[model samples]
Target: MQIAERMQGVSGSAIRELFKLLGDPAIISFGGGNPSKACFPKEVIREITDELLRDKADILLQYGATEGYMPLRRAYLDYILPGNGLHGELDNVLALTGSMQGLDLLCKAVINPGDVVLVEEPSFLGALQTFHVAQAKLVTVPIHTDGIHADELEEVVKKYHPVMFYCIPTFQNPSGYVTGAATRKRIAELAAEYNMLVIEDDPYASLRFTGEKVPTIKSFDTSDNVIVLTSFSKTISPGLRVALCFGNKDLIRKMTIAKQGSDTHSPNLNQAIVAEFINRGYMDKHIEFISGVYAKSANCMIEAMDKYFPEWVRYERPVGGLFIWCTLPEGWEADKLFRRAVERKVAFVPGEPFHTTPGAGKNTFRLNFSAEPEERIVEGIKRLGDLIREMKAEM
Candidate 1:
């Protein structure tokens, strides 16, 4: 069978491939970025789902608009957007099956083959794949512990003049770094000045456990070039596959058209459930509850790392998000460490695959805390720390 040429260079998701190793009950996985199962508001979801079936069954069971279920658009406007200092009518919003779909739709809507798309150096792997599949020429800006630097970002934008800049400003995937407010504002300014579309993928902003909440890039978007993709996966439920994008009406329309042939429409029932989840005043309490759960998990992971890992193994304790990004000493390959750790029933994602630049991040890895319990998190870190120590001694 002949596969499409676009897929020739693109490989399967590293995390998904790693999931095949998770069937072993002995393996305590720190690999996948999954929300803690305990964080789910099961009773609330069950009740909401049951009520939707009982009351809104006719609308939910029927086909939904490709644009989206109207209530979700309104709910997003009423509940989600205002918090981010954005306000818009229905035309500005489009429901997505997942925030990942927003990336795909955006690519389909605007990206042509070889169009320059700027991204954070270590970005979300899934978004990188989407850009690759679109045949976009991927360029990257470096990310520091604090996040992308504003001056550096401006330099790159001026140099590349990219069509789109994709970023995860708050608790960025793999890195778990928050781009500061000043940098975020500068990004929005640069977007307007350059006429570049900035895709702000913000799924983890609501997960903050420490520090002040920084304003979103979209909040500083004066020229309307910044597009914000918000996800309920981390906050509400990943299985629901409910996310929404808000931005320039023209861009939203293009993505809506693209979505038509993709899923026809996001599942009406799921949208309705999320809308009800918000409208009924459940989102805040739920987020607060889950944030505490994640906070405890983060603390546990950090404590374990501090106690178990050697001083040479460097890492930043994330303020929020599921991941802890770690860097082994120079010339130490994390891929080799991953193999040895897996043999001992521990797993994490190696970092090289997250970079577009050749031979980058070979000494790095990402550990997710939210998927496992406190004991499992501690145990997994111990196993990984032990493996790292053994590798370092051999060096």
Candidate 2:
């Protein structure tokens, strides 16, 4: 059997591979960006599912529209986007299996082999894999604590003339960085000026725990060059696999068509569950509740890092997000630290795989605060810190 050329050099997600070690009972895993099961609104989802099945089983059990289950799209348009100061008609929306599928469908609709796709340095590994499978030439710009620089983005756009620019503008995945309103505005403008499509993957936006909410890039979009991917995975139950994208109608139409060849349509029952969740006005209360949960966890993790880790290891207090991004000093390998840490029964995702640029992010890693209990968070950080200090001493 022969594999296709598109998948030639693409590799599995390092984060996904780390799941294998997770089966060990002793390991304190900070590796996955998984929402705490405790945070899930179990009773609400069960109620919603029961009600939907009782009232709408025939329709939901049937195949759904390739576009989406209508209510979910309407709910996103009505309930979700409005808080971010975004609005879209039905034609502008497409429901995704997860936000990751939104990326794959976008690649299918827009990218030809070898077209350049610009991404933030250390962007979502899942997305990098999708682009690589689409055989796109990946280009990257650096992302700081504040976010990617506007001027640097413009420079990259001018140089590469990429087909698309993928970003996680709010509470970015690997780094927990948020691009400010000013840069977001510039990104929208650049997208229009360069005729480039912008893919804003924003699963973590609703996870914001502190500070004023920043405007989304799509909210700043005047030329319809920006498309926003919204995922309920973090905010609701990830197992539901419900997400959607809002963007240019034509592009959305293309993606919708591409989606037909993909899943026929997203699962109708799942869509109905999320749609009812939104329409019932549970979204806000739920987000606030989960935000409180994550906020306390994030605080606990930060305090632990400060108390346990050496000052030389760098990281920031995440305002709203699941993971804390950490930078080890130059010449240190996070991969090696990861092996030793795993032996010590602790786990974190090494940052190198999140990065698209060769040789970048070798000394960085991401720790998820939303998965484990506070005690485990503290213990894991302490173990990781000890390993790092021990490694440094050897150096």
lDDT of 1 by residue, 39-156 (tens): 8888988998999999999989999899899999999999899987889989999999999999999999999999999999898999999999999999999999999999888998
lDDT by residue for model 2 (1-395), tens? 99999989887866567767579878888988889989999999899999999999999999889999999999989878898899879999999999889999999999999899999998988899899999999999999998999999999999999989999998898999999999999999999999999998899988888789898898889999999999999999889999999999999999999999999999999999999999999999999999999999999999999998999999999999888999999988899898888889999999999988788999999999998999999999898888888888898
Q: Residue 370's C-alpha lDDT in candidate 2?
A: 92
| Model 1 / residue 274 / CA error / Å | 0.6
List candidate 2 segments past 4 Å from native.
Answer: 13-15
> lDDT values of the candidates?
0.92, 0.91
C-alpha TM-score for every candidate: 0.98, 0.98
Model 2, residue 111: C-alpha shift (Å): 0.3
lDDT value, candidate 1, whole model: 0.92
- Report how far residue 33 has shifted in candidate 2, in Å: 0.8
